[model samples]
Target: MSAIYDRVALIGLGLIAGSMAHAIREGGLAREVVGYARSAETRETAREINLCDRIVDSAAEAVADADLVVLAVPVGAMAAVAADIAPHLKPGATVTDVGSVKQSVIDAVAPHIPQGIHFVPGHPLAGTEHSGPRAGFASLFRNRWWLLTPLPDTDPAAVDRLTDLVRAMGAKTDRMEPAHHDLVLAVTSHAPHLIAFTMVGVADHLRRVTDEEVVQYSAAGFRDFTRIAASDPTMWRDVFLHNKDATLDILGRFTEELFVLQRAIRMGDGQQLFDYFTRTRAIRRGII
Candidate 1:
C-alpha cells in the first residue's frame, strides 16, 4: 500500500471498482483506497464489505487531494461523473477510467481534465456477465489486456506510473488509439454480447411455441449463451448507446455473412459450405 500513490479515489463501486480495490489491496499498490457511489444502498454495501478504507458520500469529497482517481461508472454517465469530480481533483493527479467504449469515454472525459492533470483512459479486457460489488474477484484482471488510450499531450511520466500500477495488478498494458480500441472491442466483445442477447431472446420466444420446458432441456451450448445474456442491462445499454457506430458497423457485416450462409444452406451447396467452414476453422485456430 505504500509503494504507489498516497491515495486512490474510486468514483464508482461496481464490479470493476470492486475488482480494482481487491487487486490494489492484494498488491499493496496504494496507501489508501477511497470510494464513492451514487446510491446510499451501494455505499452502505461497499462499507459493509470493506471494499475501501473510506466511503465518501460525494464524488468531489472522495477525490479531494487524491493522487489517483478512477471513474468506474457506466459509459453514458461518464461525462457527468467527470464534470462532478474535476474541480476537486488534486493538481497533477492521474485520472483513468474502466469503461468499455474507449472513444465515447474519451469524448466524455477529455474536456473535464484540468491543466497539469493527466487523463489516461484505460479499459481492462476482462469481466464476467455479472455486476455490482459482490460479484467481483481479485483475479478478474489477471492475464487480461489493459488498453490505455492516453491523450497526445498527456505526460509520459503519468502514463508510465498508471501503466505500472495496472501491471502490478497482474495485467499487461498496451497503448492504443481510442478509435481503434472501440472498433476492435466492438468486434470481439460487443458483437458477441449482442449475439448472446439475441440468442437468448430467440430461446425465450421458443418457450411460447415450444413450451416452457424448453429451457429445462437446454444443453450446455444454449446454457452458455443464456449466462452471457444475463449480464446487467443498464451497463450494456450504456455500452451500445455510447458505441453505436462501431456496433452497427460490425452488426451489418455479421448480417451480410449470415446471408451468405443462408444462401448456401438453401441451395444445398455443400462445397460452398465446406469452404466456409474450412476458412472459419483456420480463423479459430489463429485466434487460439
Candidate 2:
C-alpha cells in the first residue's frame, strides 16, 4: 500500500501506538512515523526497540509537520495532549484518537483542535489482556473493527483518508455517532471488564477461599476473569471515569438481570434458568 500520510505522529507510545507504528511500517501506510511518550523511560524503551522511525521528546515535536496525528493516550489525558499538540500541528492535518469512549474524547479533544485540522474521534475494538510497548504486535488489528465518530462538519476527504489508512493497517472501518459508540462500547467492553474486576475482587475477599486455592484451582471461567482484570489499570480507570453514564446504565440493566437469575436460582425455577441461558448462548454464538 502507498503512504496515506507523509508523516504520522503517534502521541503515547504504548501498545496501541506501538502496534500502529509496526502496522504502518509493515503496510507502508505512512512515509514517516514519529512517536512520543510522557514517561522518559518509555521513550527510551521505544528508541531501543525502534518502535517508530523517530522517537521524539514531546507531543508538540512529534506532531510538528505531520499530516496525521494520533492521540493514543489515556482518555483522561487526551485534552492535555491535544492542547500541547494543537499549535504544532500542520495546517490541514487530521487528528484522530484510539480512545474507548468517543463522546468524552470528542468533548476533551475537539476544543483544542486547530481551525484547519480535523478532529475525528475513533475507537478500535481490539486488544489483548497484555499492554505496554513490549506487548504490541503488527497483526493486532487484523480483521478488527475500527469505528470513527467524526463530527457532522468534519471534512469528508479527511475521514476517507483515515479510513484508507486504517484499512491498510488491516482493520475494517465504520462510522458511528459518538454517544451511540459510547453505549455500544459500554455493553460490549466496559460492563464486561467491570464485572470481571468485581468477580476477581469477590474471590479475593471470600473468607473460605484462600489466595493460593484461588490461583491453583482456577477454572477457565475464573482464569478468563483474571485475564480481563489484568488489563492496564490506568487505562481502565480513565475509561470507567469518562464513560460513567453509559457504563452505569448498562450496569443497572445487568443488576436487574442478576436479580432475576438469583430469584430463579432461589426458587429452583429450572425452566426459567434454562430459557435465559439458551437465549444468552444464542447471543454468544452470534458473536462467534
Candidate 3:
C-alpha cells in the first residue's frame, strides 16, 4: 500500500506503538514514523533497535508537523500527554489512541485536541504477554480487530483515513460508540484480567501452604491464568481505574455466576454442573 500519512508520531515506545511503527514501515503506510517515551532508557533502546525513523526527546517534539499522532501511553497519562502535544500538532493532523478503554480516553483526550485536528479514539484488540519495544513485530495486528470509537461530531474524512491505515496494516476496522466499546471491553478483557490476577494471587497463597506443590504440579489451566496475569501492570492499573464502573459491573455478574457454580459443586448436582460446563465449552469452541 502507499503511505497513509506523510508523517506519523508515536507518543510511547511500548508494544502497541512499536508494533504500529513496524507495521506502518513494512507496509509502506507512512512516509516517516517518529517515537518518544518518558524513559531515557526506553528511547535509547528504541534507537538501538531502530524502532522508529527518529527517537525524539519529548512528546512536544514528536508530534511536530506529523500527519497522524498515536497516543500509546497509559490511560492515566492520556490527558497530560494530550495537553503536552496539543500545541504542537499539525493543523489537519489526526490524533488517535491505543487505549483499551474508550469512553474515559475520550473524556480525557478530546478536550485537549485543538480545533481542526481530529481525534478518533481507537483500540486494537491485539497484544501478547510480552511488552516493550523489543517485543513488537510487524505482524502483530494481522487479522485482529482494530476498533475505532469516534465521537458523533468527528470528521468523517478523518475517520475514513484512519480506517484505511488500519486496514492497510492487516487489521479489520470497525467503528462503535465510545460507551458501548468500554462495556464490551470490560466483559471481554478487563474482568477476565482481574479474574486471572486474583487466581494467580490465590495460587501464590496456596503455594505457601502446600510447600510449592502448586508450581510443581501446575497444569494448563494455571499456566494460562498466569500468562494472562502477566500483562503490563501499569497499563492494567490505568485500565481498571479509567473503566471502573463497567469493570465493576462485569465483576458483579461474574461473582453471581461463580456462586451458582459453587453451589452446584457443593451439592454434587451432577446434572446442573454438566449443563453449565457444556454451555461454557461451546463458548470456548465458538471463540476458536
Cα lDDT over the full model 1:
0.92
TM per candidate: 0.97, 0.97, 0.96
Scored by Cα lDDT, where does model 3 land?
0.93
Q: List model 3 lDDT by residue over 1-288, tens digit each.
A: 889899999998999999999999999899999999999999999999999999999999999999999999999999999999999999999999999999989998999999999999999999998888898899999999999999989999999999999999899999999899999999999999999999989878773457367667779998888899999999999999999999999999999999999999999999999999999999999999
Compared with the true structure, all predictions reach lDDT values of: 0.92, 0.93, 0.93
RMSD of 3: 1.4
Model 2 regions lying over 4 Å from their true place:
none
Error of 1 at 267 (Å): 1.1
- The predictions' CA RMSDs to the true structure, in order, are 1.4, 1.1, 1.4
Query: Which regions in candidate 3 have their CA more than 4 angstroms from the true location?
Result: 207-212, 285-288
lDDT digits (tens) for residues 213-281 of candidate 2: 998999999999999999999999999999999999999999999999999999999999999999999
251-270, model 1: which lDDT tens digit per residue?
A: 99999999999999999999
